[model samples]
Target: MSTEEPATPQLQSTVSKPPKVFSCVLCAQRKVKCDRKQPCSNCIKAGVSCTPGAPPKPRSRRRRVIETDVAARLQRYEELLRRHGIKLDELDDPVISARPGVASASVDGANSSHISAVVGKDGLPLYAPNNLWSTLSDEILDASSDDERDLAIRVANQSLDSEPSTPPKIELELFDLDTPLPDLSSLHPEPLQIFRLWQTFLDNVHPLTKLIHAPSIQQEISRASGSPQTFTKPMHALMFSIYSCSIASMRDEDCMEILGEDRALAHRRFAGIAKKALTVAGLLTTRDTMVLQAFVLFLLSIRNVYDAQDLWILTGVAVRLTERLGLNHEPLLDSLSVFNAEYGRRIVWQIAILDGHTAGRARIDTSRTLYRGDTKFPLNVNDADLDINMRERPQEHPGVTEMVFCLIRCEFGSQLHNQAAIEGNNMLRLLGNPSTPVAEKETFISKLERIFEEKYVKHCDPAIPLQLLAMVMVKVMFGRLRLAARHPRRFRDRGATMSQEEKDSLFAICLMMIEYDNQGHRLPGMHKFMWHVKANFQLDAFVYILNELRHSSVGDRADQAWREILECFEHHSDVLTDTKNPLHVAIGNLALKSWGARESMLAHLGQTLPDGEVPRPISVLRSQRSVGVSPGSYSSVSDQRVAGEPTQNQAFQVANPTPFDSMDSTPIDWEYWNELINASGIMIDETQYQQPVYDARAMNDWK
Candidate 1:
């Protein structure tokens, strides 16, 4: 072509297209521009040839179809649900979790799969490519053999079982997790005695606690009693705990009559054995649920002997252990037998109540778990109704069942616990927070009372011992809470504005607490719970009445209050004659001062107490202090007073101030007061009543 152009003279008229060119090789290698000359400017600078290169291949753009993907997924789900006979439109119904006609959870019977279905976040599973369990399970499910498929289904149904994760072997040897247990034959009571203890537990502890499945455990206890050598560690711990609780619940005279053994000696013996059994059972680390049950039972039995503060801390550990076992969550119970699941619920509920009670006793904040626990209350059913072999949960009883006592208590406890956990539940909290209208508090309390009455107390048959206990206990708690809601300190931070009517109401409520407790002690049917009643009788109510009588002038309500007080004191005369601890002596001294005031007022009014006679408590206290001895008083408690009489004056006065005495003008020491109450072996209740939010104002002026 060049030659022809040069010769152009012979010009062929047709022109040929030149070959297309892009960046030069040298420019391309340097990622620089090429001028299209055979040797580009960059190449010329480097004194190298610029080789031409082809253009880059075009990149294809991908179109995003997020809406299309979502639609497809939704369609796929709808089709799947349709094929499974699910009503997609009904998916949003509120009652789906608790559909009609389904039985509630049961502790005794095995639970069959529910006919109603619930969708779960994890239902549409997408197994990872390398997940070994998922792959193996899928293979098993796909197997042609019916045995393999059945086995796979069975394994899948056990939702309680976590996926097996292969962990690195721990070959290091330092301590023995499975140490050889000591010979426990001696700890095992005789077979006949075991039956007796079992019966006692069923009669006394089971009705209130309802923690044990009586029928299932009865057989185990019978076998274990005769053959201690055959006992598992957890069951062994449980058996000993049962014996300890039984003996602890019995009175000394009852123990002597029934077992021909001293109650105190038998309790100490069995309780010590129970401690050993818990240690052997590995409660802190064991995954077995019975170990926790045994631990809780042991705590309950030792309540009278154990320090409240330490017990509270120990229950904190129990609560942490409960969380470790995932008991506070409900869905984790999926696939478990109805008996096991319901018992698990019972265990956690009991632990919660114990934790709350101990915290109340210690006058401290309750466990935080109370605020957030989602575990449902135990189904209202009897011990005989729950069976390990049952396929479905039994229907909840409409009337009373073995669990009725626990159910009612659990409901009230859970609500109050959660309420106090967030908003300060006590009136004393007004010191810090803007006070809630007092009327609002009364409204809430009245509503609570009505709900409690209609829902629980209405169904109770007072003729039945357990039902009567429930009714009385609920009313007492309501009364106590009502008093707390209307405390004098809440009227004004310093109580200057407390009306006489409210003061009278408070006095009446305090007296009522003592009266109910006295009644609990008096009733022959309530004899089993007498120990509990006596131990938990609050000092607050006692101290309040004494303080009110001493510090405030009486109104028209005083006569009735005085009569009730003396009557209650007469019923609980055991306190005056039983001990001389500071709390008790303070009671003695305050009553003395309060009685003096009452007499003066009576003289001024030309009247006298009930029969113009010295009350039993006042008479007994005066006689004890004057003579330095009283009837049946040389026991462990009152003996301390008689022994230390010389070092301290027998005459009680402001020299030894009590919790109600602020004569020194010093700030109130709640901690010291709590210690005094604890030392006196009085188990206080938390219920937002004790552990009052201290006010740093002028409340120290005790009158």
Candidate 2:
């Protein structure tokens, strides 16, 4: 069978012999199988001629990467990035690859070897703060391209390097730049005094401010105790500010009791030293954060020492200093350690708070640019939870921490007016918005109040002084916000009379607020904060209560109103006698008028005490002396006034009547008083407060 086998046929195309047909070219090109016949099956079916050709040559080894070749290719890529103004270092952003007209090449920005930034949880790269004049990085990618990122970093570094946020250089007699710096060793408190001053600050100021990390600061104090010379200038400044502030918080009697120094003498001595220390520390141009801390403490502690307007101006400088330092730019902080970042947030927030309060008191709206910041809120954890070397962020504590007072206050300001949060709901705007209904405002306030109560207030132990302060402050804030929701202005703008029930509601709240104010200041353990209490004279409550007493004279409401009024005056006896301000004059007139109305109504009704003891309000009102009015202002009101006209014009028979005046009745102008009250503004339970408009230092106006 093999002898007669098929002859060996030579394969050919129609035109010529195929070059040693390795495979059927027609089938090979078409990627189909061939039967190896003169006409392949595919061609046979298609009815076309089949062509044959040799197989393609074997593929050589893939070209190896040579230096020049690789370099040239990389240069081409870098040129492309540069053309788009995108740098290799900032190529962490995939958006660059998608920019208009960017040729879509094989390179993928996400997976590019050029990017080395730490990918965040959301897949974007986290930006670290950059150095301005850094040497070429060892990283090849950074060396490979120049882009916008490098330019931006250079600009930022230049801003920080330049004299940014420089407050006017502090100038003091002992700190003349032209002269050699004076010896400040005597300014340092005695070794025992340091502990006492530090402890006093912890008890009186630290709980409210929470600016300093207690454990760390205490450690630093211990390390530098025996050798005060070792303390940095900024720390020294902070120390002197602490000394002045502690002395400021105490009454002269309390200072004598605790530190055995007269309050006025101690505060003057320490405050002067603090000013000198601040000047020496170069607070105006220093980039150090500690210098800013000392500056803030100094400004706050000197509230009563400087004019209110002067304090307001100084606070503006602090704010500018904050911005120039990039404390408001949160991205700048991403590279910082956890503890440092947290500390920066605290300082930034405290500065903002002080700015608000000072501007409020001065009735001058300065810059409020901090409101637009995206900085994250400080975590609510105690000082013990943070440390210098911490890597991972500490979890926030669930219960009341020492930061409770400060955090709540910061939260309230940031959300309500400051608008510092990136996504914070403007619940405060609702309280003051003209368009919002009273009911809706109340509902929103209730929700917010519940959050404060559950998160902070409920966990507080009243026995703790700070917690007690927080409790009263929270109530006062909610009450004020609620009152604002239903304020007379809300109805007045539309020319609507507040209904009897609304009037009663408003009356009760105003009286209640005054009561809270009295209670907050008069509590047995609240003496330490009395300086602040005395500084923040809540006159609006008095104004509103006096107006209410004018319309409604003799009911239980009047009795309660009279009681709160008398206690408030007794608590702040200095306010009753000081009449320099027109606002104070108006306040005095309203108080006397209200008291006269009470006596007349009681006298007409022949009302008598169930007990022989005179009512405390009556007794208090009669005994106190008021400015421009004699101590004899209430002399006509007999304790046994069961008949006849009682105390006729007794409250306002000017002690020395001017001969030119005809039967004068100094009727209080409600509109003018309204404007004055608006100017002497009340903040919502802030951690820091500004000095009152009245001159507190020279007059000893604080009670």
Candidate 3:
């Protein structure tokens, strides 16, 4: 009304101005005030073109329709297929849908229908034309009748009931001990061949335990050759066992040439024959010393071939028989021949060694079985020093015969007396008792250290045979390792807890042991011993050194140690590849993995360092050096000396007293003996001491 038309009456000056409320399109979209000029303020700040336009339209509010039925059906089908381990992607075939009542159909010129189509006169349907059930009797389709339907349901129910609900279990066959024995005469080799094998056994295996009197065995062999019928089953078993081990100990190529077959196969055949002879001879039920000796020999023969548990159980049997026959007690010199009594003493000590060794290896506590107070160590003399009549006694010299070294080893057996300590030292048991007092743990360590110094260090001769020296060193090192592994502060920083000197000493011992093992094969008769145990010693050293490298703060030392260990491993690569000792092979591969991991860590560290900076040696705590002790020289003990009494010159003495000492005691430190036993690497679960079959392949795979 106030426009130019109404103002026409007063037409003086009625000019109209543009509205300020209107804005440019950009400003309206941003909901900001605009100047309404050609280029608005907001458009100028945004550096965009400005244009006049209408307001934005409101979005429609239409509701979406959902297919709930289809969704529910799809979920149900997915669930049904999952129950049978079937996936949607696997159901590509039209005939294999998860939905029920959806039978596939086929089309033909004559008929096209689903698989459930009506049957024809020939009892065949066009649908499912290739189905074999189409030719079945029409009675199959007569279930429409009440009686037929009831029968069909009953049959289906019966069939379901008959089917096993769980998968069938597999059963393993047991060893057949009753297998017929091979012909003894046919199995017996020529006289020269037998002599050669016997010599080989004497040179290589007998030194392990000089239980069998060589002269007596030779006499028996000579007599048996004169009269074939006199060659008893025990004797046959003994010869076969020796031959088997002798052949097995030879170089693979040499064994193949001698046996004209693969070394393993030949050994198997010989071992089988030996086992049969042992069964037929009834040695397990016999008290004959020859049979006992033969059985023990058989145990040695199978040390590397059979299950460790089997050997352990067999050793137990030998111990029991020896005890029942009074071998564990001093022989009555008045009642028995001197040769027989001496031989009995030898056999008893041999069994003791075997018992202790097997128990240690199997991780089985032999404190109960090995406690023999009256049993004395055999005389430190060679087999040649004694006559059949025992009238000639050779003058005893230090380290002259193998018995001297053996008795030195036997001295370590005394530590087994502490049953609680032995049981507590177990790796599994130690790990479980994490909260055990540090002081209490130190007591065990101190005890082990004392035993090591007195028995092995003070009493062991450094100049002893390389093999014996190696054995002593390995036993001592293994004992130290066990104690360290059980130490409460083992995982703590080295400088804060375990001194650098202690670490260096431990590492040095490991290096020495590895070097010793590298040269072990060169030792005379060393091959006759359990090479697996030696290999395991190498592995243990490797593990300890690896731990050192991982924990050592001194970068240069750690790097140097790694190089030495890696070189050691490479040097023994041939032995590691020997398939005969699968355990060693597995340990070798594990060592390689550990080495690779160490190298990767080193590489990472190298990359993380500053470009031009040299790595400085980290602060690794060093400890004071203690007095270096060597093994004591062996001194002969008189037969007149009471059992369990340390010889006048011998440095080892029974430090700790046990409750059973007054009952039946021996010089053997049951605790030290136990430690030495475990050093052999023959681990077996106490619960599975008598496992019927030990799957070595499974053990290999497990490692």
lDDT of 2 by residue, 618-684 (tens): 4433343212323223223322122112133221221211111111122223333444443233332
RMSD of each: 29.5, 30.7, 36.1
Model 1 residue-pair collision total: 10
lDDT of 3 by residue, 116-152 (tens): 2243212432222211111111122122244432333
Alpha-carbon lDDT of model 3:
0.47
Per-residue lDDT over 260-299 for candidate 1, one digit per residue giving the tens place of the 0 to 100 score = 8899888888887787788788878878888988988988
Candidate 2 C-alpha RMSD relative to the actual structure: 30.7
Give the clashing residue pairs of candidate 2, or none: none
Would you estimate the TM-scores of all the predictions?
Answer: 0.62, 0.63, 0.52
Say which prediction, candidate 1 or candidate 3, comes out ahead on TM-score: 1
